[model samples]
Target chain A: MMNVWTLFIPELYCLLMAVVFFGLAMSARPNPRRDYFAALFMAGVGVVVALACVRLEGTLFFEAYRVDLFSQVFKVMLAMGFFLVVCLCTELNGIEERHHPEFYLFLTTCTLAMMMLVSSVELLTIYVALELSSYSLYILVPLRRGHGVDVEAGIKYLMVGACASAVMLFGLSYVFGVTHTTYLVEIIHVLPGVIGTPAAIVGLLLVLCGFFFKLAVFPFHFWAPDVYQGAANQVTAYIATASKVAAVAIIMRVVALSGGSSKYLVDMLVTLSIASMTLGNLVAIVQKDMKRLLAYSSISHAGYVLIGILSMSATGYASAIFYALAYLVMNLCCFLVVVKVSHDGSDLKIAQLAGLHRRAPLLAMALMLAVFGLAGIPPTIGFTGKFLVFAAAMEKGYVALVIIAMINATISLYYYILVVKAAYLMEPDEELPRLPVSIPTKVLTVALVTAMVVFGVAPSYLLEVARAAARMLM
Target chain B: MIVPYSHILMFAGILFAMGIFCAVARRNLIMMLIGVEIMLNAAGLAFVAAALRWQQLEGQVFVLFIFAIAAAEVSVGLALIVYAYRRTGSLDPETYNILRW
Candidate 1:
């Protein structure tokens, strides 16, 4: 008999951490420094706990929750991501001092919710978990100090998120009415017969909109640029990387419901992919703020990830997973630079990167690696990830898609290289002070850059792991 | 039966559309939140109707969860709106546009 306790170790750890943080934050005159360190320590423990749970396999909560290799892999990755974001953000200067511990409380809760989301196999459970994560993020967005932008970002994210969920719920009701079950496996069994029906197709597409919103796909991507620019740098980094990984995981799971039965679904995905890439890349070229630029970049990346998803094959799914994993490191590398260079917890512009090579050589190196990787330059993980995604689409005989993706890649290079040029070629102010980078950031930069190059050079191992995870859905 | 299932569904659909309209057209944050509440209630109504149509309890159980989640969403949402109002002294979203490209 598998005890429910065994299945919930990671969640329990996260909940405990959240409660401790909440208690500390509620105390009279909480010290931010102490709470910050405590939060970091808890995240480190979370990483260990999540890693330890990776091999446990069972079901709990009357089979609504599953513990399997697939969920475990994502849980471990999300925990590590949480740890990385906490480590990278040593200070909470952009946030009000009193709310610092509260921030960690929300962060832990969000991470916990995502872990639950990955394990949830029932529709209602998934919806509840997603809302938990969304509500936490909605609160976190507006907590930025001294900026009206934060409030705007919060309201926009909330309203849009609520609308998307409402649409998704209505769709779920249709699905439930048709299938008479909310369990994914049962729905998958029933979906094929009904999938050809117009109602079923509409419900499936509506269901995808919630995740599309989360991934910042076109038509649902309006929140990304605004929210990215408005939120604090650390918060932006979390959204850009970790939350994106969660979105990718959930998307893969949801799209798997089709089991490659419907041509209309493929067509829909293809159209969305093309639009996302073309619009995301074209709009990104004119962005002045670094965060906004990356926001558009992420949108385009979401398009590229869709290529693998649209392929509807195991290889395609694996490539998408690999791409998301690689994106986590590469995008964080970029935000790490942004966080360091901003210095005063304000928004950073493209021009601010001028003479970064002079101000901080290591930071400049990391930025160069990240941008080059993002541009799909060779001998970097971005190139490897994109190569696999494109190859997966090509294997499916999507020649036009491949060509369009290539064009978008080429178009993206101009803006990416522009950033690199600004950093390496432009001169610093005559009296500008040199940047001071802490030990943790230096270590993180080196680690991320090394991972970028190493993973690019030797992707077979990661590919194999990604294949196994993909196989679970198949 | 007191009402046909289609009639209940039509009523829910109209309520949902109106809720979406209010959410999109309104400038006030509190009004937008109310719109969301109305939309959620529409979902609950549909769930209840489905339960009666199927003579199954699962749909009713689902509605219970929906109520719980909608309450949670509203509580946090209202708190956030209050926080924003305190800081900005206004509820109009247009005035909060400090991060435009």
Candidate 2:
């Protein structure tokens, strides 16, 4: 009994954090400093709690939720993501000061929901958990100050998200009708057997749609650029990093349900992956707003991650997991620069990044490395992630797919270099004052940069952990 | 049990399509929300029919959960719609394209 309760500690801790923020939100006046410190402290503690529970394994809620290495590892990643995003909230200029507490509150709830989402093994539980996280984000997007665009983005996100979930639910009904079971454990046994049937195949594909929407896969990716540009930088960062990580975990789980048997499923996924890569990269080249560019880049990363998942092997799953973690770290580094550079909370234009090398040398360096990492340059975490994924696909004889992905990677380098050029070589028409870099941010930048390089250079430890986690899925 | 599972599924599928059509074709935000609600309820109808077909309680239970979630979704959706309305003074989605590329 005690052990079962221990498996839930991380989520419970996040709930407590949400409650604390909720209380703070109810206070008469909002003190941004107090809220920021409280959120940072609580989020830090949440990370510790998640890490402490990473080794505990059990089932809870009548086995609707499973706690295993896979779920636990994702929990730790989600916690870390929440903490890092909170660190960027030190200057929450994008949102109104009074809305600060609510911002932290929604972020906590969203993190908590994602933790539940990763652990849930029952279909109904997954739907509930996914919606919980989506709702939190839907609210958070519009909380930005002085922008009708935020509300517009929020509504679009809500509409599209609602439609996707509806399609997912419709699909779930078919899955239930066909399998007569909601438990993933049971579904896994039954689904692969009938996977050749139109009902089973269509149901499974439709189920993947909800997660694909979350991941910003090609057909479901229309909202990314606008939402990333309209929402506050911090909210966009949370969406880009933490939300994406959760989406990858759930999609992998759902895709694994096919047991790698359906040729049609593989073909469909392959098509989507290739399309996402091409469309995302080609469109990203013309983006002027930094966040919008990252949004399109995120679409392509989704494609890369899918290359790992569609391989449908333990190595594939492990590589996908590794890619997700690598993405989180490097993407955070980019957003950190975005947040700091756009201190006034306006959308950052690529041209505005001109002379960043002089304005804040450390940030410029961080942005360059992070952007290079994103472009899959050698000796960076992104490159290592792409290598692992492509290798996994190659092992599965996806030769053409891997070659196309490599071409996409090369095309991606063009835009990423443009960003670095803006930061390093392009001169500002008017010399701007140097950005004020705080001590803690400097430490964070150094830590993130080191992690990117060190992990990229030697990924053996993380790969082993990812492999262990992947084993649990099979 | 008298109604074939195929018939029920066909009915639910039509309803679902109708909902989707409303969501896509209607220019009004409130209508779009209604369309989503209709789609959800259509799914719920299928779940209930599925429950009857399988003679399992899980499907019916899932419908209950769906109802609760749909209610929650509507509350949030309406709040967002209201907020957008307050800001732009129009319920048309076309009017809310300030964030276009």
* lDDT digits (tens) for residues A330-447 of candidate 1: 9999999999999688989998899999899999999999999998998999999999999999999999999999999999999999899989998866746789999878888999
* Model 1: per-residue Cα lDDT at residue A320: 94
Instruction: Please identify model 2 stretches exceeding 4 Å from their true place.
Output: none
Error of 1 at A318 (Å): 0.8
Backbone clashes under 3 angstroms, per model: 0, 0
The TM-scores, one per candidate, come to 0.97, 0.99
Q: What is the TM-score of chain B alone in each candidate?
A: 0.92, 0.96
Candidate 1: stretches off by over 4 Å: A1-3, B1-7
Candidate maximizing lDDT: 2
DockQ of model 1, rounded to 2 decimals: 0.63
Candidate 1 TM-score to native: 0.97
The whole-model C-alpha lDDT of candidate 2 against the native structure comes to 0.95
